[model samples]
Target: MRYIYSTLGKLSAEQLGMILPHEHVFVDLRTPDKPGYGQADTASVLALMVPQIEAIQALGVTALVECSTGGVGRRADLDLAVSLATNFPIVVPTGNYREPWIPAWVHSADEDELFNWMLAELTTEIEQTGFRAGWIKLSAGDDGITPLEARILRAATRAAVETDALIGSHTIRGSVVMDQLDIIEAQGGSPARFLSIHTQAEPDFALHRAIAARGAWIEYDNVGAVPVAESTDLILRALDAGLGEQLLISHDRGWYDPALPNGGVPKPYTVVSTELIPLLRARGVPEDTILQLFHRNPFRAFSRH
Candidate 1:
């Protein structure tokens, strides 16, 4: 069954409502070798992040894609607790992050081993926590994908092909994304199932169109962090270029970081619901198109095909 797997349950797109395609509930960005990198008391994390999750629910945002992955401290079990407490859904990732933050074991692991790990996590459960991952979260370096990073990405790409799951990368450079797609295609993964996350980091909108042209998802996830006008201008330009179907927008916000005291300050996941949508409406973006972006596109992008 093709479905968007959530922490609570497997649901259809309509069941998910508006989705923050790229957001974090709890993240530990410290290097894996560091002390207490991805570990946190579930109760402590829930206490800090549940209210933030509730705040978004009030604004009609229902689910969010938890971008926390292996290198960056993904705790699907921790996120599942939050989903149960607030009756909210969280889509989790089953992949690794970029270099430097990547663990030594990952560097030593071979391509087939990495591929097997991801396939098992996607088909079975992550860390044997009784929760399956809904998609793949990956990242490439600013200049280019390293040899180790390329192996990991290649493994993720192959696993995504096998499971019919989506692959989203926190890629910095547009050129690197093109390289990543080449590797994915070589491994039999389609660009249609790939996502160029943090697409705004690449200042060239021409590259944005290029990504969309290749059939991958182009995500503008820094919505709340940047000026509303700047965000809208890019989004409107995307629509004008006839790339609406391949576009996504989000806050890239939230995250209860265990590394910080009291998990630091979490940004609210409300800008897209409260601000950007309204601005788009005022700019004559049709209601149907708005629904397509927040409602339909998320499901299409994340659902297991």
Candidate 2:
């Protein structure tokens, strides 16, 4: 049996319906040095996020993977508030983002210390929120996995091994997918429970195929950010190569930026629900396959057995 640890509580994998594998209900991407950057008020964020979530729910989305990790304006409390408001399950993560975004304490902590910290967050509650993280989220640089990023990744793998939690990584330029996998395997982590996020950024179908062949998951998130045709083509190419079971799709959307007036341009969570799915169907992708992409794949990706 497998269950997904959500902000509200643990839910059976079957309970995850039409999940958005990657999304951010509350995130502040503004630079910290500048005023108004990363300054989203909780009240305002809740007000803005709930309705958007409700709208996605109206479209039959039952769960979401809030990929906002530490040092990237992850608001676990905000995620809880929105989940409660909309009666939706949200699976949040515990880990750190790439350099500069990562906090000093994380950078200074030794591997064992970091591993324990992540393990605690996965098994226990995070910062008194009483919400255990569902997965470990990590980020690497475009050039490659930096030393700090590697440390975080290795620690995350160890934590996953202990907790049986999933690990999702933000791969820049898709350059270090193999290296990341090598480290996870070296640390005794299961590649099947790992996800190479932002995979479409690389546009190398062979790379995507290679990663999927290793029993890891490939995420084609960035739906609205990239052109729909190109994104769909990449997905179709992967499916054609018989990697559908190991594939995941999402918009990577939703963010309430406080820097601009009225929280900047709102990236609605409906792109995958409204635009991408319909496009896939019209392109001759079977309905069951679409269901697998939206529902089954997410359940397997987030669940801990």
* Cα lDDT computed for each candidate against the true fold: 0.90, 0.86
| CA RMSD of all predictions | 1.0, 1.6
Number of the top candidate by lDDT? 1
**Residue-level lDDT tens digits of model 1 in 96-182:** 899888988888999999999999988888886787889999898998989988999889988987988999999988999999999
- What TM-score does prediction 1 earn? 0.98
User: Can you write out model 2's per-residue Cα lDDT over 216-242, one digit (the tens) per residue?
Assistant: 999988898978887788889888999
Which regions of candidate 1 fall more than 4 Å away from where they truly are?
none
Candidate 2 matches the true fold with a TM-score of: 0.95
Q: Give the residue spans of candidate 2 off by over 4 A.
A: 31-38
